[model samples]
Target chain A: MDAKETVMNVLKDITGTDLSDKMDENLFETGLIDSMATVELLLNLQDELGIDVPISEFDRQEWDTPNKIINKVESM
Target chain B: MVNIQPYGTPEYFALIILFLLPIIIGLFNGRRFVNYETLFSLVFLVLTFGGSKWQQGVALIGYVIFEVITVGVYARYRAKQNNTAPFVWAVIIAIIPLVIVKVTPAIEGGKQSLIGFLGISYLTFKSVQMIMEMRDGSIKEFHPLAFIRFILFFPTISSGPIDRYRRFHKDYVQIPDKDRYLKMVDKAVFYIFQGFLYKFVLGYLFGKLLLPIVAHQAMLQRSAFFHTGLSLPLLGYMYTYSMYLFFDFAGYSLFAVAISYLMGIETPMNFNKPFASHNIKDFWNRWHMTLSFWFRDFIFMRFTFFIMKHRWIKNRIRVSQLAYLVNFLVMGFWHGVTWFYIVYGLFHAAAMIINDIWLRFKKKHKGIPHNRFTEGFAIFLTFNVICFSFLIFSGFLNTLWFK
Candidate 1:
């Protein structure tokens, strides 16, 4: 799968809900991913895509959306 | 040998504002008088640490020198290579003074440590944060001068809304434009007035005036309720003390943030509408936001990451629950090494665990009703739980039972 698809799958796995339709929605605001889930998501991304975003660099505002996550991973 | 507490009296405020006038004008004229600002900060620091508090002043200087060397050495080592052992040592060394300060009182029959000074906990927080960030490679360079200024930025020095190093560095290096500076001035003025209302008026009413009366009344009823000191007056004391804690701390935070603004540094705020929170988790997000956020990022999140990486706990829920317990227990200990503080930590940990369970259940059950009434009830329940925790935190229970 592509990076976007991989990220979407990870988000769905963490939240237990499909978030493909809400790519721009804030995962934190919607209660889909809290601090715990955010770590899980990061770990999953590292395992799946070798995208290692340090916790310090993870600004909640910048990475709050699936699309943003995809973009961040792509940029990295 | 005049001693002045930050925001302690009308005279202090008046003197500070007069000193600040030139910096304010300089900002308006699109110039930052860096040297003068440094001089102003030194004068204030001397005022705070001079005279009767000279011992603390000595301690503060010693503590800052120790931390700068510790963090500086770590930063230099981190520049060449990544090693866990050195980083761990750096963190432990950074906190040794604070540990000594905390443990001295507990072991020595309530005698304050000679090395202990006001805002020691806060300074330690900043130092630890720097070390952690350095390990992460986010703070790549270590400038001792900048670090010292960040640690001693006099406005929030005594108590902080806890400004981050990078954020403070950015503001210190850049001057805000005229329009932005003017808006900041407006906000600063508003915050000063609101602080007056919260600290002088409400804090005085609840903390200085009403708290003692309620506490005395509760003590009078110590013979009631199996001599447990559980009475109606005790409940009143809980709510009153909670209000006092919020107003006094929040008021002080407002002054800190306001002064930082006047200096063209945008310090983070400490409180939002914390009492209106719908759950314990939400309450933490709103209350003493900087400290809680600090704990969340450094302790809770880092602990979860460490355990998960090590595969120590297979269950994710268990991992998070353990993190909460550790996070809050550390926070409790940070407040001081006392029974009430420790219990306060454990109480919050339990509350957080229970809150998570309810959240998960509510998420699963779509049949649960959602409305304003339920939201209100949730807030009411959260508030009471928090106040009870604060009562544990207040050490009044210790006084009632042991003293």
Candidate 2:
């Protein structure tokens, strides 16, 4: 699967909610994900997309939305 | 020459408000009174660390200088290149003072470290956070003066809802528009008065008046039930200590955050109805939130990544469980090097592990009741567990067990 697809799948699996439509919404603010889920998403992204982002590098502004997370993953 | 500790009494608040008057007026007229802010910081620092505390004042100055140099050097090195060893050394060096401060009391039989000052831990957290963020390339610039302002931000210098460096810098450099500033002032007033109720009234009643009464009874009735397991007075001691700890710390946090607001920095909050939590994980998200978030981000996630990268922890569930244990253990040790504190940490670790297990099981068993009654029961259980843990954390366990 593509990076965007993988990100969506990870978000869905961890949050137990579908966020495919809310691509531009703030995941943290919307209560769709939290710190624990964020870690889980990072691990899943690393495993699936070969994108290794440290928790230290995780900023809410930089990757608060699905599209931003996808962009970050692809850039990495 | 008048010296007063931060938030130690009502008079301290009055003095701080008087000092903040000019800065507040300056902000209203669209000027930041930066010099006055710096002066207030120095004056408060003197109040906290001056007079009988002059030795601590010296230590704070020396510690600040050392951290500034260390962080400045680390940031320069990181800007040029990314290396693991130097980053590790920088973090170790930054934390060395705190480690010494924490350890000295244990080794010296409770004689406080001479080099220790109030809020050293909070300051160290700020500095070390900068170093870590710098290494990650998130904090690209390291201005020395800005760094000093961030560390010595006096409102939270003593106890913190430990604010983020970048977030604080953003607020510090900008003067909020009048409407926004007015709203902040309103909230600040509410928080300060609410803090008065929490700290002075409820905290005094619970901690000073009731805690001693119950604690004394617990000691007198120490041999009432099986001579070490459980007694009525011990149970009373647990509830009283739990309430005292919450009101005292939460009240202090309100005062800190409220003062930060008055200064135009939105310091993060430390509590959010923690007793209403239905589980250990939820409880952490509510109680001493900044400290817990710090541990989660810095310690737990990092350890999980380290173990995974090395393939040391192949099972994901086991990896998290182990990480939780390590995280709480360090937090426990940070509180003190005592057996009770260590046990308190272990208790939470174990509780969280069980909580995670239950959550997973409940997820599978969808037919299990998930309603208000069950939720209330869960909250009640979590509350008692937390109270028992605070009893352990209160150091009363040491008196009960060893003394």
Give the TM-score, chain B only, in order for the candidates: 0.99, 0.98
Please give, for residues B1-403, the per-residue lDDT of candidate 2 as tens digits.
5667788899888989999999888887778998888888888888889998889999999999999999999998998999999999999999999999999999999999988999999999899899988887889999999999998999899989899999999999888889988988999999999999999999999899998998888888777667773678889989988888999999999999999888888999999999999888889989999999899888888788778768886787898899999999999998888898999999999999998889778867889998999989999999999999999899997897778
- For model 1, the stretches where C-alpha displacement exceeds 4 angstroms are none
Q: lDDT, candidate 1, residue B139? A: 94
Candidate 2: segments with Cα more than 4 A from true spot? A12-37, A46-52, A60-76
Write model 1 residue lDDT over B1-403, tens digit each, in one string: 7777889765778899999999999988888898999999989888899888999999999999999999999998999988989999999999999999999989999999999888998899999999999998899999999999999998898889998899999998899999999999999999999999999999999999999999999999898888888899999999999999999999999999999999999999999999999899999989999899899888899999989988999999999999999999999999999999999999999999999999899989989999999999999999999999999999998888888
Rate residue B362 of model 1 by lDDT: 91
Q: What is the TM-score of chain B in candidate 1?
A: 0.99
Going through the candidates in the order shown, the clash numbers are 0, 0
lDDT comparing candidate 2 with the true structure: 0.88
